[model samples]
Target chain A: MIELEGLTKHFGAKVAVDHLSFTVRPGVVTGFLGPNGAGKSTTMRMMLDLDNPTSGTVRIDGRHYRDLAEPLKYIGALLEASKAMHGGRSAYNNLLCLAQSNRIPASRVREVLDLVGLTAVARKKSKGFSLGMNQRLGIASALLGDPEILMFDEPVNGLDPEGIHWIRNLMKQLAAEGRTIFVSSHLMSEMALTADHLIVIGQGKLLADTSMADFIQENSRSYVRMRSPQRERVLDVLRAEGLAAVEAGSGVLEIDGATAEQIGELAARHQITLHELSAQRASLEEAFMQMTAASVEYHAHAAGEHKVPAKAPPGAPGAPGAPDQPGQPGQPAVQWGRSYEERRRRRSSRKGA
Target chain B: MASVPAVLQSEWTKVRTVSSTVWTLVSALVVTVAMSAGISALMKATFDELSELEQATFDPTFVSFSGMILGQLAMVVFGVLVVGTEYSSGMIRTSLAAVPQRATFLFSKMAVATALALAVGMVTSFLAFFAGQALLGEHRTTLGADNVLRAVIGGGLYMGLIALFSMGVATMLRSSILSLGILVPFFFLVSQILISVPKAKTVAQYFPDQAGSKIMQVVPDALGSDVAPYGPWGGLGIMCAWVAAALLGGYLVLKKRDA
Candidate 1:
């Protein structure tokens, strides 16, 4: 277990991590979420005693990381990639060096190489390996001592889909084995599937700490998408039926609160032929944006309207749906709790563009 | 203490695993031995022209120390590779992470480097001394007579000390390029150039390389009175002092500074 109490890190006048406190317990993958320059790396560095904390303490397994007899056996960390002295030495030799330091058995080098699927290339110099291959080697080095607490900063930064999937599963499996696996990443959708717990941060401050399921269920809302040959007819029926609905596209009306069953029966009774009907729960990414919209420090032009919806409180998971238009009937005037599904769809569509 | 042994093993791995380490050590041995033998042979062929006193003072031990001038360059390379590589590659964080006992780690590195240098120095010095003497035949100096062994052994000790000295500079500079910039001229060119200046010779002899090189002399030169504060042993002592100061400074920096 890693417990950080009132941890704060200040680089000269700039507070990189500001009075942040949280516990990364064993048996779960706690995703450390933040935007670029959000101090995620700084916090991780402090946790391992790499960077001194200006205020507060981070204890690993009840003792400071530096105070431990053998730190690698207690908490293994991968703060940077391809950091094991380059390709000058073979991959096996690199791990062997670390093994000697941590008093790990020499044979474990081969085990970790095999574990990360680098055994085939273990004899090769790391310099010749691709970025993804290097990342796996870094991971293998981290697992050298089989420590119970593992912290990885942006471990999936340069991985392919297959490698990313491998890491996500590895994290989950490690957590299942009762290791405290904390990983940081910018992609919220990936975090949704990989992280059991989320620690969202923005501008170097902790925004939220909650279970992923609860965060999604409580903070995210569900919405229904609808389309009809007679768009106007569907719009009138939705308004008369007191269903909050808005025109999403030329003939599509996005409906909320009413289920597909109710919408289908109502459209059928009105003799309106429905062309499309789909219900979407808020995605973790939208909930993240909704929670962090205002706190985002750097907004890329590509981030687009995906800015945290105006309604969701900073760190609050659920907010009401953001209006498709400036003013839609179902959409609340207050921009909060945008459904996660709508956020995902918006991001996906944006990407598709 | 066992932990210290483990640390030493780890540091050994660090040095040997890098091809640069192997290349630098090999280069040091090669350049130092080859140059010493070559210089000794050239000087020996002209031995008949030398005064008895000149010949008496010419300890073959001093001859063996020749490679050190060149070998020290390799020593500097080795020292810098061990410490500066971490800074250049940003691997110090990983190193410190694996061994959070910062001072122990540094000490272990120093111990490993010193031991390796001493062992290699002893072999190189003995061979250079023996080979140079063999080549001189009638003029050949033997370890059987005079203070020959002292100079020969001192050559090895001098090499070991200078290697540690380089390690100190590496710690202070923390960058291979900068350390090389500072070490090369001070040990190779600057001290010699400075001492050549009539009045400045007094101060130039106090340089680490000049002081350390005193170990090569069997007789104190007249220059010792005006240039060096002590005899050859004193010069080695001064160099050792510089190393101690550098190592202490490095330890403090490693202890207090963030990786």
Candidate 2:
């Protein structure tokens, strides 16, 4: 188990990591999510005691990293950069040196090389290896001691499709063995597929810590979208039923509080011809964007609509009362917890009408 | 805490696994021996053309070690590479992760490389002495003579110290290119050139190479060289002081800085 208590780091007046506290429990892969320039790398470095923490402490198996008899046997880390191996040395020898340092058996070197599928290139220097090969060699090194806690920072940056698939399964297999696996990535789609739990941060602050299913359910908007040929009649019926229905675009109406079954029965009772009635849940990417909209540091101005106005509170995930139109100044903050299917249903109902 | 012996073994593996270590050490030996023999032969051929003072104070013991002027550069390369490659290749982070105790890692690596350098330096010194003496013919000084054995053994220690000093500076600078950019010129050009300049000679004599080379001279101020204030042992002591200061600086840098 790795526990960080109020861990914080500052690089000369710029707060890189601010009081991040969390635990990575065993038997699950925890995906560490953040935007670019977030303090994921800094937090990992502090866990290994490579960078001294300014204010807090990191305990690995209840002991400080430096206090452990042999750190590699307790926690293994693969940093974002594939920089842990000597290019002048062969793949086999690079791991051999690490094994010897930790008093791990020399035989384990060959085992890990085979595990990473680098047995054929064991004698070749790493300088001649491609980025994928280098990443595999780094994984081989990380597994040299068979530590219980494993951390990887952007392990799939330059990997091919097959390599990506291999690593995803490898992480799952490792976590299944009751090892604590913590992996960080900026790609929400990748995290959604692999991670069972998520620990999210934005601008070096902990934003969310929850299970994957719960995080999506709470942060994302899911609602029923309905379309009818007689858009005016449907709107009148919805109003008479005391349901607040907003016209999306054309003849469709977006209702947030009612379920598809309730809306379907209501339209049938009123003799309205219903074209489509389905529920839509926002994608994980959209939920992540909404959550970190204010914390993104490097903003590309090309898409002006994506910009979250500077006045929005950084801690507020989604603030209401923001105008939804583009080209409008002082637009009230975006309303979270509302599904986008309403807008699409309005457009479809207009086409039908 | 990390096991010292384990780390030492690991450092040994790191050094021997690379081809550069073997090539650099072999070149240091071959170049020193071959070049000293060549210079010795040339001196013997021109023995009749020498001036009276030059001929009288020739110092045959020092002549056998003349190749060191060029050869020590190879030693410098070997030392810088042993420490610098860790940073250049980005292996230091991994190595430190295995052994988080900074002192254990740095000192163990230095111990292994320094021992190898000392062994190679001894072998190279003996070979250069024998070959250069054979070429010198009648001008050669026997090991049995006074101060000759000290000069011979001191030659080996000088080479090893040069390499160790380079390792310290490399650790402090943390880059092979940056360390070499400074050390190569300081040893090959700056130190040598300053020794001959009218006003610079006084301080230049106390430089690491100039002071250390005193151990190889059987006669004071041999071959019209500048006379130093200290004796042979004192000069070696001065060089050792420089090495100590460098190693201390390197240790502090490694301990204080992030990997």
Native A-B interface contacts kept, per candidate: 0.54, 0.83
My TM-score estimates for the predictions, one after another, are 0.84, 0.87
Per-candidate interface DockQ score: 0.47, 0.73
Per-model lDDT = 0.77, 0.84
Q: iRMS for model 2?
A: 0.8
**How much is the lDDT of residue A16 in candidate 2?**
91
lDDT by residue for model 2 (B29-91), tens: 998888999999999999889888888899888988989988899999999999999999989
Q: Considering only chain B, what TM-score does candidate 1 achieve?
A: 0.90
Model 1 interface RMSD, in angstroms?
Answer: 2.2
Kindly report the root-mean-square deviation of model 2 from the true structure over all alpha carbons.
Answer: 6.7
**lDDT computed for candidate 2:** 0.84
**Best candidate, DockQ:** 2
Across B100-162, the per-residue lDDT of candidate 1 in tens digits comes to 888888889999988898887788778778877776667566787766677778878877877
How does chain A of every candidate compare to the true chain A by TM-score?
0.80, 0.78
Error of 2 at A151 (Å): 1.3
